[model samples]
Target chain A: MPGSTLLHIDGVEKRFGGFVAVDGLSLEVKAGEFFALLGPSGCGKTTLLRMLAGFETPDCGRILLDGTDIAGVLPHRRPVNMMFQSYALFPHLNVSDNIAFGLKRAGMARDEIATRVAEMIALGRLEGLERRKPNQLSGGQQQRVALARALALRPRLLLLDEPLGALDKKLRDSTQRELMDLQRRLGTSFIIVTHDQDEAMTMADRIGVMNHGRLVQVATPRQLYEQPASRWVAEFVGDVNIFEGRIERREDQRLVIACHNTGAIVAAAPRQSLAGEAVCVAIRPEKMKLSRQGPAEAAIQAGAINRLEGTVSNLGYLGDISSYGIALDAGATLRVSVTNTARVDVDDFRPGERVVVWFEPDDCVVLDP
Target chain B: MSTRQLFTRPARRAAIAPYLWMVLFFLLPFAFVAKIALSQSALAQPPYLPTFDLTAGWEALKAAAATLSLDNFRLIFSDELYANSYLRSLLVAATSTTLLLLLGYPVAYAIARLPERWQPIAMVLVIIPFWTSFLIRVYAWINILQHDGLLNQVLMALHVISAPLVWLSTDSAMYIGIIYSYLPFMILPLYASLAKLQPSLLEAAQDLGASPAKSFWLVTFPLSLPGVGAGVLLCFIPIVGEFVIPDLLAGSGDMMIGQTLWLEFFANKDWPLAAAIAVMLLGILLVPLLVYEHIQRRQLEGKQ
Candidate 1:
């Protein structure tokens, strides 16, 4: 159901004093799409979310909701709602009353408001806590109340700022699952702001990675991880071994880089114009196979030439996977992870073992400097 | 110890020294006042009849107690002057407290919203008047409100008035004096409450589609009720029993209860009637205090 642009932020900029919180940021969210603004803290993701929720106005540019620029509109008048990170439920109001606040403000009929509040209460699984104030509820219950209150109005767009930040791990997982299910069911366009990459990768239909108040790249989670737009995005999204090098040659949909760390690296599916001399070859930790023998003997894809010889310097056994820090003879350290197929630690590489690490050219992302 | 006893220990362990002081200073004096209120005024050193010493025998104490009656209270009820003064005092207290609230809430809110470093400075400005003698400040108001004073001169120079306004010895002067002296009392508690209000709550209300005014009334105002209750009580109780401001600044046409009580005690030397009036005023004041206490307890219970 993701069709057409539901919201467009065109070169929006916000500044507090002289510090640019959000600088010339542009994005488009599709209708019924779960969009996440992913970044580190102080990356202006929350600021952009605040602007969408009408708590702030951009110093320049436009925020269009359904093609209507809503700069002059007040927050209460805008068809946008937000679930705050603090889950700012009204402490004075009971659960039902908190959920009914927006409906009441919209001047809905009393009976209709009551019905909507009851539905929300049922949705939040707060059946018997209708008359309990926010302070009386647990953290999860308060989070539910915040969600019910914001969703009660049925706004066009719902902005959530780190909605699961206050929850414990178990609650966070269940809440994330429930949120994804609820979004798919309601088909409401949600733009959630979070610094947690895992939450973004799992829940978002499209993730926009922000850095220094700018959108570095916006793509699907898989695309972002596999082919990041730059070395920063490549390193920021996930753990990757970036070999800084110069582009030596460009063949048909293929390129070779003379790396400073691991020497020449052949990469495939070279999408960008191979115009820049300096570039970085980004390879995911799991893409490379490690073996005491060669790549073919290790059951890796045949004819793979992105190979290097290194000694295992460090080993991390994370129960499900074993990660190895390999120090190449050329003096570069690369982290490689392999799935622990056997339960009793069979065929696992150890520290100080000399190993051959190799990956196919397709697994390598050639990014411009 | 049992859980019940453990839970009850704090209340039971409340410092006994304060209670002892209260007995020596407040309770004992109040008991003497009540005894005098029930007795008849006489042309004696202490000015009340049927007085008994604690060292006296029980028979003597009983004889004195038998002579004590409700005649003072009966006289106060029958007299129109005391009733009228009581009503005037209540009206003044109510109206002045309303004015104080209207002026103080916004100032307190502004101070609370100031920058972090400036908040204490703003609070200091609000309480700066406390550094001066309250009597001197009220006396300063006397100079300002009197004929040919600074206020009238400024007004006349601005051509806002043709003649000097009769500000002194009027209800307006009395109210001005009361408000000036009690403004800090109204603002301090209000500021404390307002400053503690989280900014996220207001933003949440706005985010949830409540307008600025709606958010204030719905979230901000209701949350600050404790401060409102405290400020109202702090201003209302003393203003109702106020004697100095009305005696100094108000006209003699209508007397407040404080003035009437003072006249009865000092000029007329009717100590019994004055004691009865003081007890009645305290009774009236206690009504609001008890109501406030009940609300405070209910608020605490609601939190739990």
Candidate 2:
């Protein structure tokens, strides 16, 4: 079950009047996988999730759950549950009753429903707050009750619509980890939609970056960060300095590009084919380093390495790293980050100081325009 | 300045204005009625014995109070006509309120679920009947309910009835008038509450595997209870003391308390006994309100 496809969305499209909310999007979610649909607001991540949960029917699509088309099934008749972003807990029901709602609806025996409610309450670590109404509980406790309620029926695939969106920063972090653990133990597939990139990276096994109602790229979080599919995907996932360039040379395992401002740049391996000479070379700030002088002459033999000479234009002393904005000679500004490895503020780089920024070729991502 | 002078003094006056108005208009009149209920009927101008004289001072007032007794109350309690009217008034009020709820709830729910642009227009339709004068509407109902009237003609045309049905001077006609008049009062509050309900709550219920009917019972109805209570109290209280429709439509076989009071006060000119009946009817109406308040307090206590 873990390896098999549980939910197969084939060319799902939803339109509101003239505006397309979900384009012709197709995807497969493996059973027991922690998948995240990551995007900005109104990017159709929420609309796609709603379609899976039977809240919205697609204009054209086949939603196959274990090889049965369930697109026309009523929401109450479907074996799917969604944890709403607002939690949407029944305000009148107490914690125990909220957890037992789905179970009782399924016509479970009274004793069995009580036992499942108790188990879910304990699973959420809400021991003493059983009788409290949803309004009476704190925000964190209310979220747990919502989660417990959604999980009560053991749905084939649980949908979470930004479930931790209401919690504060500190609670959000811990809850994310707890949610990961719970999903792993339950072994029920989960597809969580969120606009926060960090939350998806922290909890999802794989991430799908969506834009304009279509999935731009889907990959493991590390792959999405280290090897993005396009310039937009690279820039959207994390902070990156993208330089306009054209392919200068192509080899078996590596390619070299000549940037208009920074000059020649070599990439060890490019994921996409050389669709055109015009492309974007992207590098994360932390992957490159800064120093007062250039590297030793032995580095010149390695043709894939890059070296840029610039004066530091701006510097930010964050607690863990110092970011330097370099004003390149050709008028292109590049951002480079250096990790703070020493206790004291040593290796001080300040604004208006001359510096050499350098990085290896593999640290760079070659993205198509 | 202190809080009392700067803040609370003005605020306190504004808050006390309604109570002061009630004391002058309501409590004082009730006191006069209570006095009349206790006094004996008389052949004099005021129709009650031992009227207090201000010029005669404290001694005369004391003598007037001593003459007041519970004799009118005893007489009304012993009479079958008064007893039957009270029961009939309560039963008609309760049944009409129930019918209003059953008929009005779905219409309110539909209006609330309408698109935002249509809701205000639909609500105006509900309130439009109130523009016509109430007496004119009741008179129109008389025409519709009479023999060979519009209702019988329609029924005959549809072949639903073999002949003209006897509708006038019956409980059915009385209920029809009361419900038609009070439907707006029932619908407005129910719509207000139902519209305030989050659409997501119903979706959440369905996602949790509740069928449409079950979701209404579990989520929609429970949350709209405050509206139900308000609507019930609003329509039931006034309908219990209703006079116009009942007197115009209901048969002479049974009478409501309002008819009894009118007859006792105007026909027989027994002001003391009529006042006593009015006081007792008010006491009976207070029972439901007291019960509603008790339940409200217990719910609050349960929450805390």
Candidate 3:
């Protein structure tokens, strides 16, 4: 690992008696990156975050921060701070005192502590309510107090465990933006743990998706969405139409796959080996276009657009886009999204209407079945 | 009245029953005591008839009052012997309460931190000592604190002590008995309050760069103050009136107000003076009770 790597978790594992909670997880966070550990519940995302915060010790790994092994370091001794999911603002302390708590613990002089606390209070936009206890503040204000308290220490790495999980929808959205902006302004690395895919997509520079105590994939949100590494990742990231198949022919960068259920030949990018082997072709909903008629140059070009005839089963109107669930002739349903441009009446397409769904060869990704 | 009005009567009566019970059980006894405190001593006796004569009651009050005559108050306070004993009792009780808090806090914290599966068992263990008789538990302390007692024997064998030290009939023995008798009172409430504390608060403290000790003092300790207040009041108020532990552990040396009241009533057979002393003790105990109630009420209002 490079010296600039802020956090290095190497082969970290945790077990509770007979069950493994975190199994041989290893990852690196750069100095100023907004990293996210994203997964569903019980996927070890929070457990990994706890280990990084020093609340949990890994059963079998070394955790390095700023190029030094911190496996045995206590949470208080570490140069990292955490913001809890509940925004664990001290109910007894007012906003200023709560933010000043960490500085006081560090034994800073009284004047310096006061100045820093005032600066943090202003930074959090809590200018006047310094003497109001946490119970008197709104949920968003309490969250800001929590943030100010954590940031007062100026830690090398900041860990947030579902920081926005407690807020209402509007507050959470705004706070998510504010947190990203704050991280950028401070140039501090943040490792946020969340189960919400949208939260991970909105704020993270890189996301590590975990499943059953294993890191399935770590990539940028766009990369994870567009080029999922496995069948699980493909289905997890977004709405995708997956067709189990075997590769029938191999071209330069594309493979002709014969889908098992639909019995249709489709062309996809050849990323994984599948010649005469079982595989699955995954195409995003927005990548597939629904047309009333087939394309004109369908069969002539190499890797031509594959067409599937299907009747619309369900239509979802989402203001900006309309999603159509097309029940194909092979009995497998395929989702297709179309932008609602110019306030067109085409979004009112009902069920039982026959439509041809087509996607380019580059739009579909081939993975091992 | 309408049907709704008729139905509301029964609901209101049911709601008022608990308050009525409290008044009957608690306030009624205090009222009787107050009435007795105001009556003439002769009239306060059996076949009691309270005459509403201001002269006789006023005389009784004046006689009981400690003017330049520190005679009655001096009977308990002026003598260095009695004064030292009272001080010793207070010192013992205060020390025991402090020890109980120190020992009980970690036990409560440990029990609270235990997994849900283990919590009930831990709580049961803390409560199991209360099932035994308190007198028997105090007697058990006597057996352990005696000169040739198990503690001394073990310490002697370990060469920690050269001889069998005089452990019984000492202030230390009295403290041990008091703490052993009242420990469960401290632990249960502390455990209950500490158990309800959100674990996220501790995590938040750690994340905010607080060390474990600092976090505990700053967050956990202050949050559990209500329980501490409850435990201290429960232990202190009762122990302040305690006569049994001192009598059993300290022979004639550890005389307290309860023992003094007992001697004044039964030994001296001075009914008027005993009643006067009883009234004085009541006044002493009531002040703390009132202060505690006021504090508790203010706390409740703050919460609201």
Candidate 4:
């Protein structure tokens, strides 16, 4: 509805007979913004993307692009293109021809099609491989060809369905950066659907986490990580230590949560629910600290820096950081991540060692249970 | 490598067994046909000779050549009747093959797109006609197409036609019979090929701004060419050698090569002339077979 909005989906719903794939979903993607619809399988992320591309029409709502309702517009008539999860490069067509397919379909002049195809090949760094078919190219090269084909049309908006799902980790990482760079360079509005949280976090300007055909939260990656709006969002985004608790007191800005397991009062600012009600304390694992000694007086003085005693059950070595699974006395496990700064011999904390895990009051999130 | 092992054992067996079978079934029969072509008929001992006399056989051949000569081949080429029959058969087969492709493609596409539960059912429907007699099916077409037949009766009752049309004993009837008889051959391979087509290709075409029709022509059609080619070959090759439909529907009015060969063998009682005609027919079929193989080899090589 705003001037910056490039694509608008108004209460779009999709159903296959009795099964509701996407239900009354509404969202707007701003111009020149990289928006990601993040969800797991069967979460309606891909269905929403298909509706945007005009492959699947919404049963109940309208999809508008550039302020025009495109409910009845055919996929070819729409000013949008999608990069399918499988890449779907035409096996019969070579790289150049695949890139030039849309242009040729539009009956463009030969010279113009050739020039645009050449430009796309250059832009995709697919030079000298124009004559090679899709099966002849490597996975990454085929991905580039698919991307080139979708981008060649210069659509107003681009829909990418799990764009990097087919690549290996190392290649995915590099290609993710390349895609972000390309998006920025083109300044085209992009709505990418992916299940990978890290991919959404790393690539998107704003991430819309979806669950059960509903948008759980739409915010920047950091905001989503730090201030998730629901228990689903908190758990879906990252590894969170959720402690069942009841609210003890209410303040204007924060609420004091009395956790049952540790018998510790924790402070968290409730974003939605009122204080003095049942809530869950959601603290990110990486935000917690593990120490041989007890927590500092300052942390305890902050009204409820919940301290817990646990035995290290397992250790995970992750290059720059190490994670320890602390089995608490309450029969719950708390994961704590520590930075691996130096080659300290004491960094390798073995199993069965008693440790104290603590986090600041501000690090814990108060969410409705 | 596993491939080498797999091929080596099979290759060794194939190399010896096929040759043995070919010698037993093919070469020996050809030798028998050659012997019969050369032998002289005896009046007393049921057309047997005590010993083979090569000169007598040569003289018989020369006499037959003098009488029969290239006269049959010349007659086939020059006589407007024979020329028209040949051309009509070609046209009928070609048109039937085209119709088969048109009807079979959508059926194949539907079967391919059907859900997993319905796939076997669809496949069974495609194959069910094979369990029945082909002749019965062609005869059924006669019942549907003949004057005052089921189709005409229905049409007249519906006020669609004032009179029954003469649909039998025509090239159109021959076309319908051939197409009906050969439809399963066209549909089965097409279904196999179309079923294997990835849906993502169509999605990609749509995502690239090509309309559904354009996508079908540029993407779906070209990719399915191998199936079309296979279906055409499956229908066309056998129809070229077909005699039953022409005899049943054309009623001796349209004499094809198969009918000609049949007449030469049965009515003329000239075995050597029949063999020559057979050889000519074999020549005509073999060239196309070799060409098809060459084209298939090139296609395989291109894929590699």
Candidate 5:
């Protein structure tokens, strides 16, 4: 659950010449939420973030910060700061001065500026580097400096543009955790714009997936992965096997989907749907189990389990899990991943082997086609 | 070693070739001038005493060395004309360079901020003036600035002035010529520095609560210092020793170092005196050149 809304973005639209960068988009960001705008490049996540920071004016819309419309306000006057994707630290100034820039501009006393600079240096753990210019710092250190500089003014909202884009895998992992801690400690609303789904999932309180120029879905990371609103969102968040079908019947909590190639597939349709309605059955690869024995001989739950006969076409060993691609006799390919809980296996599945892939009806998600 | 590694050795050697050329064409001539500055003037074929005589014995070589003196340097220092000419040259060059910067900076900034496709076209426009000979360009200015020329005619027609302004054959005319001739020198480096600046930096500055004007001062200007220094050096150095513009436009009344050096060498046939003047000019120019070099080295070190 989110707190009281702090930013009310209503029908904001931006266009660069003829290309619409951000279509009519409306969203509400909670006061202390660490929200992420996740999308592929050119999906307008960055343009939306820039609008919030006041670097770009929307073609038509009102963005209310705490109920006050700040449409005409300049970026400098707006109570928002952004950490650029390139960090954009002032190359000429030392780390301490860079952090102190905003404070000094606000007419803070020299002593006060120094004290605030010291506090930021401590917060960023940039000790002994106060006098070093931006170029003198390492990439990770530069990122921290940028973060510290953005946080110094204590803006109502902090916009981060791909904050961890420049870091290596090892550094990015630790930095993501650190950023979450910082945002939580400060209680400032954060809007991170990134294309990395895993980064958004690991750090954000809620993720807003964008496509083309509009927000497709906004949900918590778990909900976004488990119950994506559409097929595009499902495939974008994580690996999912899609079974295109039409609703044959809705019985109790199960939806009997008449899939073309696989004949019939049962999915747990959260929403009530009429018979013959077009829908897609989305099942995560990890939810499906692979066995050499058929469902009837294996004695899997009769009506609750959805089973398909297929031959293993390919397999990938990912240390923690083994993913197998199964080509069904009905002319559909489905992927199933099994956890490698134990090294020794009773039956090790390989390519060209006959297998039965099974998943419970509860594990299936039915989305509108 | 691999074939590629073997190739790098010769490439490294080849890189030193330009430095050798600089030593030969630039340093050797300066050394000759310096040697002449220390020698006495004579009516000989070379027109200076104490030539390096290999045919002469050790005793004659020593005698020739004895002929070398600092009299020409002393003469230059003692004469008010030579001293004032150096000062006047500095004043004109400094003023012209300052004017060029004030005029060129905005043009360069505008070009740098032009759309990506238009940037190269605008840069070519700036360099297009350079296609014509520098002398011809300066002469074109004279046609416009002359009392009965296009400028006075426009001023009169517009009722801006009743009398024709004596625009030519003055220090102001010389300044116009110097600025017009050296503007490309100022613009090119400035454009390069400004073009390399990431737009994100300015955006970040504004995001950090600095207004547009403040951002320009706090971020943009400071980052463009390298270009400013480079453009200043490019214009200032040559203008300090500038001859043609001042000679043609400003007349011979205000004698800069170049014209003085020419008169000393050609008119007075005082080779040693001219060499002494050249050495003094070099000495004066060294301070800024060395400062520029120091800045460049520091920038390189910062990058590393």
Candidate 6:
């Protein structure tokens, strides 16, 4: 549900001396979309964000904002603002004055600045603490002032470098929702850079997973979770048990892979894989059902379910569900989770019990190893 | 006694040590000076009458106090030479401190912004000038500022000036000497504060549509006020009482309070008036010293 593209990054490359922090990377962020650049530390996500904010000049290529190429534009001249990870609020200025900083720089009238400052204070929910300096406020309050200061200019795009990094877990969660709501209200394209996958998944409309100065994949959160484009993205996004295999045969829509560890498996083929192609069959733990007896339900033998027999090696009871680590006879470990419907069940399985972990063929994701 | 009480007793003693030291060394010395300032100048062993004798008991102390007068302080206020010296001391201190700030700020800022590995080396370079004796440094300046000195010779050779200028024994030379001597005092505090300034604050200012120059005025300059106050007080305080620089580099007309006090004590043999002058100088300097301490304490509390 993203609109037209607002910021188009074309083949941007940045190098600090000989170490290339960001390779030739291209990306497009839609208008009003909360796009997250998700990566591990040192993956060049921060470099790309600095380039977008005009803090760092690209070595090559162009960044177009609303169809205007912004090459050689200085940070202050560019219509983009960044919220730093440290929540670098001006310590000398109060909350209201900090929010009014950009407006005053733009040469707005005093009354206009006051009104805008008031509006931003209200927007950031900083009503009573207008005169308190940044150090006088709490960490979460400082973050709000940083956000209000950045947004006061009404930039077409807002770049946040670990926006919720300084907040505690509870505050980070609430702030994530507040940020999403703010983005929707302001209708500005927000490109947030973070290493936390859960933060990216919870807040971003679309996420670009970066690895080693390159974009591995750009997709919606659900798509990135369910259909990751590579093995790295698969493991980075969520917990998945990957079965290394070579495709033995290809039917019309399904592939039967002769796996090295989990034996033969039938999975829906990726769009580009061929017969004998080496790939990984990835299945999320929550997708598989664990049963101690032979197919407690009749769905296991039905030609659709891919079933593997194993012994329960470990069991974890998390209040809502039970997770079982099953070691297959073919020398592979597969994790299976079952919902805890009742407080206690008569058929609950424990360690050393033989089990059949079953899943639909469509549930398996074929990813490049 | 309980273990907590035992620990608290020694902790309390340790905490009170500094106050005791200040009272014994600083306040008691000032009290002696104040007592001397209130005495009468006389041709005696101590060269002042109405001495406080502890062994003579309270009756003798009362008799001594009855003879004490504020005549020396009254003469200091009424005398033109003393008043002019006080005013000139303030003027010299203010001007030299202004010059030091102008010269020190950029150097301190450059050192602060240096690469972390080079910062220590740069700071050492600023302080290396102090390794030489201060008196020798002032004497060296006098040699260089003389008519046939290195500066005039170099300037004459470069055709910048046609003749050897009268650079020695002037107010300007005294100003130069004071500024050069106290520059490290200015730079060190400024460097300490500027180095601790968060670079991200400037970056955030720039990101919020402020230019680099604007960011400095809006963020960097304001944040460095603690250092500025400290540097100003450090330079201004000692420069007011600076005797050697003005005595060596300046003419007789450029008399500061320190030179005045020295002349009063040694040449004029007026110990009471000299003590009064010293007490007044201390009173004048105490205000800024207290202000500097307040700023340092506020900064420390903010860090916590």
TM-scores for chain B, listed for all candidates = 0.95, 0.94, 0.79, 0.79, 0.94, 0.93
Candidate 6, superposed: residue stretches over 4 Å from native: A274-276, A294-303, A341-348, B1-13, B290-304
Which whole-number lDDT from 0 to 100 does residue A190 have in model 4? 83
Q: For model 3, how does the per-residue alpha-carbon lDDT over B1-304 read when each residue is reduced to its tens digit?
A: 4546766777977878899999999778766554444433343444223433456777765555422132445455555654564565566667788899998888888998899899999889888887888889888888998888899999999999898999898877887788878888898889988998888888777766677888899999999988998888788778877888988987675587677767866786544345545656666667767888898897665544
CA RMSD per model (angstroms)? 3.3, 3.1, 5.3, 4.5, 2.6, 3.0
Our model 6 lands, by Cα RMSD against the true structure, at 3.0
Candidate 6 lDDT over A1-369, as tens digits, reads 358889999998999999899899999889989999999999999999988877789999999988999967988888999999998888778889889988988999999999999999999999999988788898888899889889988898899999999899999999999999999999988999999999999999999999889999999999999988888999999889999988888888888888998888889878755344888899999999777555545675555677789899998889798888999999998888888888755477878988888888899998766
Give TM-score, chain B, model 6: 0.93
Q: In Å, what is the interface RMSD of model 3?
A: 1.7
Interface RMSD of each: 1.1, 1.4, 1.7, 1.4, 1.1, 2.1
Error of 3 at A344 (Å): 6.5
Clashing pairs in 2: none
Task: Give the clashing pairs for model 5.
Answer: none
TM per model? 0.90, 0.93, 0.86, 0.88, 0.96, 0.94
Model 2, span A242-309: residue lDDT tens: 99888888877777888989878887767567577888889999998788877775785666568888
The per-candidate count of clashes, in order, stands at 0, 0, 0, 0, 0, 0
Which is the better candidate, 2 or 5, if ranked by TM-score? 5
Docking class of 6: medium
> By summed lDDT, which 10 consecutive residues of candidate 5 chain A come out lowest?
A267-276
True contacts kept of each: 0.82, 0.76, 0.73, 0.76, 0.80, 0.78
- The docking quality of candidate 6, as DockQ, is 0.62
Judge candidate 4 at residue B141 and give its lDDT.
83
- Shift of residue B147 alpha carbon in model 3, Å: 5.7
What tens digits encode model 4's per-residue C-alpha lDDT throughout A102-184?
Answer: 99877899999999999999889999999988888889998999889999988878889899999999999999999999998
| DockQ scores for all predicted structures | 0.68, 0.62, 0.51, 0.59, 0.76, 0.62
lDDT of 1 by residue, A47-109 (tens): 989888888899999999998999657888899999999998888889998998889888999
**Model 2 C-alpha lDDT versus the unseen true structure:** 0.91
Ranking by TM-score: 5, 6, 2, 1, 4, 3
Write one digit per residue (lDDT tens) for candidate 1, span B155-235.
999999999999999999999999989999999999999998999899888877788999999999998988999999999
**What is the C-alpha lDDT profile of model 2 across B76-162, one tens digit per residue?**
889888888999999999999999999989999999999999999999999998889999999999999999899999999999999
Docking level for model 2: medium
- Tens-place lDDT per residue, model 6, B179-278, is 8899999999999989989988888888777899999889888888889998999899999999999999999775999999999899988899999999
Error of 5 at B263 (Å): 0.6
